[model samples]
Target: MVFKDKGRVMDGFYVTGHPSVPVYVLKSGVIFDGGFTALARHYERDIRDILGNTSPEYIFITHSHFDHVGSISYFKSVWPDIKVFGSVNAKKILSRNGAIELIQRLNNISRAHLLSYGVNDLYEGEFEPFLPDEVVEDGSVIRVKDGLEIHSRYTPGHTRDFMSYWIPEKRILIASEAAGCDDGSGYIISEFLVDYDEYINGIKRFMEMDVEVLCVGHRYVITGDDVRSYLLSSLQHAKDFVEMVINILNEENGDIDKTVNRVKAYEWDPRPFPKQPEMAYLLNTQARVKLIASKYMKN
Candidate 1:
């Protein structure tokens, strides 16, 4: 199922995490049309619609999620000069997997785990992939024209390689998926089951920024006076959610299924559901499970 078109492209969508930042209609195209309903290349059309014949100079990805990177190759095909930047680790992942294989994996997995919330059909078939020409490591500054620098801070915990971009000049902070989400409603923030600690710290890091505008991945941009408060509330909720799950696991004597179910039972903000769970949760779960298994193996 696809997210209903709230309005035409450019209709103001409210971002949740930070209330002070206003989002422009930079792009309204969906790489994954109707949440993976079609196998065709819809993103090309989406970009054309939003850009209206103007090619974008920079495309910044939050991570290596299939949907986020879906149209990357197409963008490269159209504009040879366009530069695509993403977390350094994501670039490594792309380098190992040929673009055709990557797209094929996403296409095939499009509808595999519907029982899992936010599961959509992955892309199938072979498509060209655009390997990043440059990797932006954590703390690296991405300077756009005229001294607008987007600082790439490594905020591990989402994924080992996830980085959040900070603009000190405009005081605009683009958390990618780091700042949680706004969900275009009143205020909706995302909670991940990944490294709850890194997730928490990631949110707190934004508080230190003199950020007045916040743009998060997968939701409408948010801007307002209550940005900081709302973001903190979201962070606390994630902490509590993870802590409760850990506590329940301890009580159950390490019942993995129960732990998973308890974590799942926590109320997920509906708005972010369709676009999640983020890649961080997938990676974090694997990492934590490995850590748990290692302990038992050693014992």
Candidate 2:
């Protein structure tokens, strides 16, 4: 089953924020990702209402992307003692001035975009930069409480700092972008921006896990038999998408710009509302095309 609404996925897991940029909160006081600042602000009341007296203790960052970490500073302001966790590379990325500025800019764009779509109840707070309280390497286990333990798995490629959290006892995997995103269009958009091979490997690793519930980075929370089905299909889609990009690059005479434009027109341009912003989409598509070109194109 795929859940696209903002509500409780089960007893303790709740999905808040716009479907375009959803945030996951666990009753164990752990958040999967921060999501966009504006959307986070819009859903603050809902998230707080869901949490009630359970103050969030930790935030597990999947990556250092603008959308992913946009609300960390806001979250910190709410829960001053909440410790943020991310990969070592994410810590570095979030600390850089240029990256922070870019994140703020993208967040503003998202804010305007949401307002244009009639979502005007967003809080007026700005995006703030923050560093992770602790960096978790691959295989690191975070003991959230007596029965819940979150195992961090380093799953890169969408970004070098990407990390996915796994809860063995609950059979849940908070795989933000590591398993790609299902835009509810019956397609898994392959987001291997940094390294295609690493992305593919990450999906394969996820396929080997015992997951009953799969929470992706955006749009959908999959459960039951669909978890493995989604993993298998995501792996296949990544492979096929990379191969398609390679073919396009070759046909375009190994021109990265042309290939990116071509792929964007074909895959991204026709997407409906609540899709990725144009600038972010073009940037990520360029990176993916460049990676494919560098790896597969003949000299």
Candidate 3:
């Protein structure tokens, strides 16, 4: 799908062949969120068709999660000199040998699942090594073209490395997972793997922007008058989830599994793709449960 604001043009493609992997391309040839390598390799031709020209000057990564950046190598294979941008923490995560191995493992799992769904055009190469060519901090403006500037907003809850992008001219905010995954049904599947507090704060920061178009990291994109509501509702979801987790733990007498199941009843909305895998979601829920417990239940 494509949208135009002012004179700037933006188009979205499932670069990774999964609804969860959104790669937004600007007319200036800047790509947002490269997605996983295996899926990206599978859909490289389709992605190239969308861009018309496969080469991009820069690819901005929102976070260093395996899903978000597993395909960094794909672009390098196409345009070896394309500059990659990400948060400092993301730079560190992608630099480690163990992290690369873990990312590759995650890539394989996603590939198999996608193939079962009949997406058979995936490429034959293995995921390649990557280290961000540039580490971006909050308040950085990357001038990819003469009149277009990409602004970075550091949102470090989805991961300490998350950084969402804003384009002032288009009033577009590529909110990434920081605004939570938009379930294609007006709901944000809030993810707070590291810290609930930071997640909430990040949502609030997005709310402050004059965002006319909110491009998520996944299935749906928000535009028109609905952008504000999306951000507000996403904030509420996070607050509600954290409160529910804390309350459930207290009521269950600190039984983590029970609390997870109870909270699952509320958080799990079978909307569509872009939702985390069940195993991944449960693991994240467990981490969130334990984090909140240590902070509040430890009296």
lDDT of 2: 0.87
| Ten residues in sequence with the least summed lDDT for candidate 2 | 39-48
1 against 3, candidate with superior TM-score: 3
For each predicted model, how many residue pairs clash, with residues at least 3 apart or on different chains? 21, 0, 2
Q: Per-residue CA lDDT of candidate 1, range 30-88, in tens?
A: 11111221222344444455566766567666665554555566556676677777766
> Please, what is the whole-model Cα lDDT of each candidate in the order they appear?
0.52, 0.87, 0.74
Off by over 4 Å in 3: 1-18, 269-275
TM-score per candidate: 0.68, 0.97, 0.88
Cα-based lDDT at residue 247, candidate 3: 78
Clashes of 2: 0
Top candidate, metric lDDT = 2
Q: Encode model 2's per-residue lDDT on 88-120: one tens digit a residue.
A: 999999889999988998999988888888997
> Could you report the Cα RMSD, in angstroms, for every candidate shown?
6.8, 1.2, 3.5
RMSD of 1: 6.8
Enumerate residue pairs that collide in model 3. 37-70, 42-122
Q: Across residues 240-286, which tens digit of lDDT does each residue of candidate 3 receive?
A: 77777787887999999999888777777444543565666777788
Error of 3 at 41 (Å): 3.8
Winner of 1 and 3 under lDDT: 3
Cα lDDT, model 1, residue 80: 66
